[model samples]
Target chain A: MKNLALSLLALLTLAALLLGVAGCAKEAKEEKRSESKTATETPPVKKETIILATTTSTKDTGLLDVLIPAFEKETGIKVKTVAVGTGEAIKMGERGEADVLLVHAKKTEEKFMAGGYGETRRAVMHNDFVLVGPSSDPAGVKGLKSANEAFQKIADSASNFASRNDESGTHKKEFGIWEALIIKPEGGWYIKTGSGMAATLRVANEKQAYTLTDRGTWLVQKPNLQLELMVEKDKPLSNPYSVITLNPAKFENSRVKFEAGKRFADWIVSADAQKMINDFGKDKYPEPLFTGDSTLTTSK
Target chain B: MDLIYLGFKQAFIMIFKGDRLVFEIALRSLIVSGTAVAISMIIGISLGLTIALARFPGRRVLLSLVNTGMGLPPTAVGLFVALLLARRGLFGFAELLYTKQAMIVAQTVIATPIVAGLTVAAVQNLNPKLRLQSLALGATRAQMLWTLIKEAKLPMLAAVMAGFGGVISEVGAVMMVGGNVTGDTQVLTTAVVEYVGKGNFPVAIALSLILLTLIFLVNFVLTQVQQRETSSWPKRISK
Candidate 1:
């Protein structure tokens, strides 16, 4: 009888522990749901928190460090920046998990806006994508004027090309170039990283292959990489970053900080923020990482 | 080589200087993985004990399933959990995706099979006569089972170690479900990956060293616990 009691106690203890964890998880989920509901109903209650989903390049290049702090100081709103690929950032926006999105994938952004995921979209900055490869220039397309021509030469020579196959902005641009050239690049020579720009750059550097990368990330990673800017000055290689505010009405269940997101969007294209973006990376490199141009704005 | 040395130095500095971010990330990693191992231990040990002692139809198939689960890839588990917890997924109503709880769930899924498989092996390794002897002593079924578990405690500790090791070192599943959100879901391994992605090799190396040291320290403690009976040299001499 005593042994039965002890065993029962042990089983109960285990059960209790499991229940405790499950209870906590359920409570947390409930708390979040309730908070989001409240946030939607009382949008003017003015929550101090704003969630910004953005591309890894912005984070890798330390642009968010400067821009976020400046915006936070100006508005007294804390920004929680989630740095991911542009594709993931846009997905977060579509899901209403983020209040704002700062991304570089124009095509994806247009689709997002057309789907009514974004309330406002404004171009904040621009940076060109450069085709980087080992100084060996195995494809021998260093002086190529067009990205498509360079890609063709790489395909013709069957030189190694590392692709960030994560549907990121740079990856999409690369895909565009390939599509324009009508080349379905698939071979052992084409390596798919399925990672961020910097990681893909490292893979390209290690493999001594060519890759498409934003000038910002490239400039930041230049000192460490063995690769050089093999192709640039292409019309199709222009990379522009835009700040998008998630439409609160479209996602009534989400705790979207519509007011704070709008403030951030306006501040990003404001004169001071534009100047800050324009001046970024001047000290360490020959040119700034991004050109702040408020002239380029896209809407649905 | 120099980078390795620099990594150690940086790790020590980060530890000693009480770097808030590093400390937070390490603490979060411990809490997340530790809780996962604990939960897996409960389920795995119970299931393993049942499988080892109980006689039932399809037991062989169940054991085979557990064995297969032992080799399940972390990324596959991560993807499964991600799909389940995604906003459009079945349990999307819970709003658990990208949260620490989601990370725990993914790690638990990855660790449970390891714990269960090792546990089954450990329990099976015990002398079958031990169960008979315990029952002969007029002990009840529950008491006999308890005695068998006590005899198998050391190997069970090994199960604990393996489970902890499996989840602590895992990066893929956690990265997918947890979203690697800085100051939130960023554990040591994911943080190492992030640093490596940014080409900050020194920081990445430092974080990797910290992870290794953490795993070593945890296993060392478990080893001490597992060998506690044999550790008493003076008691052995007196005997």
Candidate 2:
């Protein structure tokens, strides 16, 4: 009998948590308000759904795991999230396949907007990428101030540099550093994983190699990875995330949920959601995963 | 490995705790793969029977195509479907991209050829004289086809199991179309991918274990049905 009772309690708690994943959880306060509203002669309400295409770093840090639910509970809008490489996320937005995008490729996002794909673009958060390497520091590039110099050091040393090579934001940033140094970076020393951040980190961990990763994901996976933050706080390493809504008028006859997407875009920058973003990961990790700053850091 | 041990620990904990997330993903996996296998069985078995029992001009070409589909890479198929269902694609008006229905469509495309190609082998392996004997015994064309199918029942069951296994274990195509969008389209396979992305190998392994147990239990049941004895077990034991 005691076992049954405990199991039931566990079940009820799990059911509540499950609601967050389904993106339909509502606060108790809203239920009463909804009940009062329904007492009057009212028409049916269409619950809007939007597909938010975002990058793997933001998604893997488990930021949206909490923020999306909070946003959904407040607005009663259902959000379906898809995490891909930043390039893929931007491409999806360009094709009107995604209603809204939360991505970190600043130059690409600007190009997308100039191409008339975005109705509105707002900076949501800021973080920085760090060059992480095995504690052994095979390349002896630790504590480097400039990302370019670090890349050059690693290349000249012929150190194994694990690459994501999947066109992710991190990959592009790493490539940009190499391009700045006029290095093509094709050799046996460069290992391409063509995977997400964590997988590349694992390869780096196993091989004692070096790779670039956003701080948010790096912090979250610190306990499991053997890599150390080698070069950080570089001007070229700052990552700025933006929320861009599709030009609904451009996809007038398409499946773009303009109003709901706009709500998410406008509200994410609001005081409430910004606070949620700012406070995320502070309790678990040493510091918050991201800063809710819209100033748009001047970095690559 | 420590990772494997931790995964076992997590799986046991999640199971005993009645983790609704695990149950939700397991259930969705079953539903998506189950529906796809059933639909493919219908279409594939019919096509298999038609090609095996009749003669046609392009029958050789069709057979080769089915055989090719059985060996086709799933990720390639996923890309094809993604393009077809993209907002700017030919069927963009339906807006089925990134939905569960779209996953079913892709899996069906993946499983159909396996079912049809195997069914062709199953039918061809039977004695050609059986059809003649059924007709000689005055069985109607439909009735003869039914007998022919009944004779190939065991192998056809194998085909169904293969189709289900292929679709459920697949991650590339489902991720391509369904987008692994949390509770809506996430199945056990894609859930593992998500956890692995977080560097949570324990949880990822736990999800993979759950998926494996799911596939094992399904195959177990199908095997039971496939290998059931005609005589009562007690009678056979006495014999």
Candidate 3:
């Protein structure tokens, strides 16, 4: 009986301690929030955080690192970027967990907009996708005039092809080309690495397979990969990235934070941010990863 | 092979130079995983002691459930947490999703079961004779329970170490819950993943080396505490 009581006491102590810690955490957050609320009223406006759901390509290329801080400094909004695949990023935006989205995948973005998940989408920059393969050119796909022709030849010969089967924007584009030619690629030759662009490229390099990749990531990672550029400058391979704000009117979050979200969409397309995009990677790569040529900032 | 060599070279350089980014990430990993293990130790040890000492209904079922949870994949755990803390979930009102706190909650959920399972084994493994012996010696059941706990201290400490090791090295749960935001929620494991995804193998390997070193330091300290001579009862009982 004594042991039971003692054990009960121990359990109670544990419960109390857990509750105390949880309470303390809540109190701390509440205090910080109150402080921020107060500080925002003063001259030095405190930073408010908003989630920015963007693609891994933007982050992997080290673009957001520069852009986020600059935007924060200009607008006093701290952007917590969640760099995921375009599909997942849009999913986050759809769930209203994100304030804004920067992604590629025009088809998916259009569907998202049509579904009322986003208010607007604006083209921020453009970069072409390239098909990379072994330098030996097993399918003789090198110097192909079109992406479809190269893909058709590779499919005909059953040459190894690496697919980033994770439903990323790049992955979707690869399938788009396959569908355009009515080729349902399968078998052991079609390697599906459910990984990011850089990882898939490495797998393609090791397996000596053909894979579609954005020019920016290809240029940045080409030093380590043995895969040579197989097909380029294809009309259908032009990759355009867009920024979209969450549909606050649809979600019923008619707060001022929606304005902050719009501000980000505007700031990215502004002359200053566009200039940053144009200048990015110039010192490292022969050509910039993305081109900022859009005249319109953003629209519904 | 050459890449591995380059990775080690880079790791050593960063270690010797004490890179700010590497150390900052390591510190975050230690704090987040450490707090999680500490919380788990309390709840798990108590639950394990009760299950081991008392004859409660459905105790066997609970034990098996904990055992199953011990092997829960980090990704599955990540998904579970992502749902619970998501704005639509039960605790969504707290708005704790995609924060360090959410990472802690997921890790605690992960580490608690392992700690509890191990604690059950440790206490049960203690000679049943010791329990009866204490009760027969004019000792109250409460005193008997304390004696048993003292005897099982070593394994319990090992349990805490296991829980720490599990959470610190885990990537998926943290990535899902913490958002892997650089300089905020990003820890060593997610940093490694991000670097690898960027094809920066050397930096990734270097971060992994730092993680291993941090784990070793933590385990060494914990092992020292676990191995220290608190009592000679176990030795005497063996004889």
Candidate 4:
């Protein structure tokens, strides 16, 4: 009888432990779902999904979500966005995994075009990259007249700065300005953060280090962050976003979605879409997120 | 084929150079798998021992259920875990998806049943005489319990190692849960898959070779441990 009681207790205990452990696992998964906001967005309609390869800033700023549904409602074409660094996005275009590519790096996009993997590269919109840092402006670059000046001040002052280090569009621009300024960002002042725009921003915010970011994402993420835009309105800081359809000439499978991608690319540059971009974050940011200057040429 | 050879060569140089990123990935894999093994062994061993010794209604049903769980597919586990941890799932409140902890949890879930069923069989195969002898010698119930556990140690260890082998080489669960984030939650197996998918054969081969070697070493050790313990057991009457 004693043994029977002991065994029953043991069984109950084991059952309890197993149930408890399983409960924790279930709870952790549930928590992540809630935090990632998986409930609000409806699943894409079958047979109407279009894959868009693009940069992280567009998604991180909640811009694409706003744009995709409007396009979907109008065209009945659901969009599936694969947000990555510009480098990876271009690669996706080359692989024909993406029906369309919206990226900011000009030279790289040209390479994709020259390689015959991309067609009809459309200039969608333009936004300027801003050098943001602690409000104190420890590097004394807060009022710099130009991006090169700000970068020079940063390098000369040897103040801590974070680099995206991920070969992203922003990283390419930063390297460009550095090269133009004839400054080698060496020593302990430069920290490499191999992450997306939002993550790098967070890291920079936490470290109180200076970093360059698109005005759109910065405006959206500003309220929640502590950094201030230190440099802006420079010609060198101008960042333009372009959409390129995977060339059907090179990839035969890419033809099926080519028209669908063209519709989206065309929609993004339409006057209506431009107003949406222009008015985005006006209430919170009080400044336009992007300006549609499709005719503006990129620096080679 | 030429591209494959170059990729392989590059992968070798990257590994031998002790690339910090690669090491970071390997370390995360070890930590995640190690945690899974520990969690599985603890839950599985206790449950198995209890199921072996306990006389309860529906015991046969419980054993059958556990045996079924042992064969759960890793991809299915991955899908369910991804769903549960995804932003839309009920458990998304914990924000565990795409994190190392989530990967460990998924691995443990898949590995636990294996440990439990194997351990039950191990304990069930132990000689009944050891417990009887301990009782006859006037040992308390707790003392007899210890003796039984000690005698079954070899099989339990083997079961634990088997569980480790199961989790360490699993790709789908880790990939789904970890998001295969670079320098964060990536593991050897997932990295292997990623490289292979990218047509980078050398890195895939290198990572695969390492995983295969580790699994073989674990199984080899487990066999040796089981053998030593079996040989040490008394053959006469103890059965």
Q: Model 3, A1-300: lDDT tens per residue?
A: 324333533453465456546645865796567556546554223456788888888988888888887877666677889988999989988777788899999999999999988887898998999999999889998998899999999999999999999889999999999999999999999999998899899999999999999999999889888889989998999999999987777888432246678889888998999999999999989999999955855566
Worst 10 residues of 1 chain A by lDDT: A1-10
Interface RMSD of each: 8.2, 9.1, 8.8, 15.6
Deviation from native of the Cα of residue A29 in model 3, angstroms = 14
| Predicted structure with the largest DockQ when compared to the true one | 2
The better candidate by lDDT, 3 or 4, is 3
TM-scores for all predictions: 0.81, 0.87, 0.89, 0.53
When 1 and 4 are scored with TM-score, the better candidate is 1
Poorest 10 consecutive residues by lDDT, candidate 1 chain B: B224-233
List candidate 2 segments past 4 Å from native.
A1-46, A248-253, A295-300, B218-239
Among incorrect, acceptable, medium and high, the docking class of model 3 is acceptable
List the candidate 1 regions with Cα displacement exceeding 4 Å.
A1-51, A65-82, A95-99, A143-145, A186-188, A248-264, A270-276, A282-286, A295-300, B1-18, B56-58, B218-239
DockQ (Cα-based) for each candidate: 0.18, 0.27, 0.23, 0.04
Q: Which is the better candidate, 3 or 4, if ranked by DockQ?
A: 3
- Flag regions of model 3 displaced more than 4 Å: A1-46, A253-257, A296-298, B217-234
Clashes of each: 0, 0, 1, 18
lDDT by residue for model 4 over A1-300, one digit each (tens)? 323333533453454356546645765686555434433454323235466778877766667767776776566565666567898788767766567888999889888888988768888888889999988788798878887888888898888899998888999999998998888898887989987776677778888899999888787667557899888888888898998876677876332377788777777777777777777656766777877765553322
TM-score quality measure for candidate 1: 0.81
Q: State each candidate's chain A TM-score.
A: 0.84, 0.84, 0.84, 0.80
CAPRI class of candidate 2: acceptable
